[model samples]
Target: MQQYDVYIERQKRKRQRLIRRLVLFSLITLIVLGSMAGYHLQQRAVYAEKVEEYEQLEDTLADLEHEELLLEEEIELLQNEDYILDIARTNYFFSKEGELIFKIPDESPSY
Candidate 1:
């Protein structure tokens, strides 16, 4: 009977040790999974921000390229003598010989 009691005690201790090891392993696994989830969330946020910034920069680049094209068009127009003369005539009231310019009032008359 004493040997049987000792064997039963040893079996109970083994079961307890197994339970402890399982609990420890579960806690460690939970900790590792939580950390990985947090890291993934952080990296996703960063990637989202970078993607938004890249889109904004792309829009800015497109705008600058459009502006550059407009400037090139203006440069080409300025190279033409007729376009320059037309601009000077409209803005500065410059006229060729034998041409008459009428000065019209643009403001509304207060009656």
Candidate 2:
């Protein structure tokens, strides 16, 4: 009966040790998983911000390209003597030697 009691006590100690080890392992696993989830969330937020910045830069590039095209067209038109003369004739009231200049009133008469 004494030997049987000793055997039972040993078995209880072994079971307790096994339970403690399992609990420790579970806690470690939970901590690692939680930290990994947090890191993933942080990285996703940074990626989203970078994507937004890239899209805005693309829009700015498109606008600048459009402005460059307009400037190029204006430069080409300025190189034409006929277009320059037309601008001068209309805005500066310049005329050829025998041409007549008329001043038409743009406002309606207040009757």
Candidate 3:
């Protein structure tokens, strides 16, 4: 009877230990999962910010590319002899040999 009682007591203690271990393991797993979830959320926010910045940079690059093309066209026009002559005549009021230039006054009343 004594030996049987001792065996029963040992089995109960073993069951208690196993339950405690399982509870501890579950708690640790929950903590680890929670930490990982937080980290993932933080990374997502950073990624979203980076994506927005990348989009802005891409838009700026596109605008700069368009401006560059316009400048290139202007440069080509400036390099042409006929375009230069036209620009000089209009801006500087230059005339060819024996050519006449008339200064027409504006009809609007001056303030």
- Top candidate by TM-score: 1
Overall local distance difference test of candidate 2? 0.98
TM-score of every candidate: 0.87, 0.79, 0.78
lDDT of 3 by residue, 6-51 (tens): 9999999999999999999999999999999999999999999999
Error of 3 at 72 (Å): 1.4
Clashing pairs in 2: none
For model 3, give the 10-residue run with minimal summed lDDT.
Answer: 95-104
Per-residue lDDT over 1-111 for candidate 1, one digit per residue giving the tens place of the 0 to 100 score: 999999999999999999999999999999999999999999999999999999999999999999999999999999999999999999999999999999988799878
Worst 10-residue stretch by lDDT in candidate 1?
102-111
**Model 2 C-alpha lDDT per residue in residues 73-93, reported as the tens digit of each score:** 999999999999999999999
Candidate scoring better on lDDT of 1 and 2: 1
Provide the clash count, candidate 3: 0
lDDT of candidate 1 at residue 62, scale 0 to 100: 100
User: Local distance difference test, per candidate?
Assistant: 0.99, 0.98, 0.98
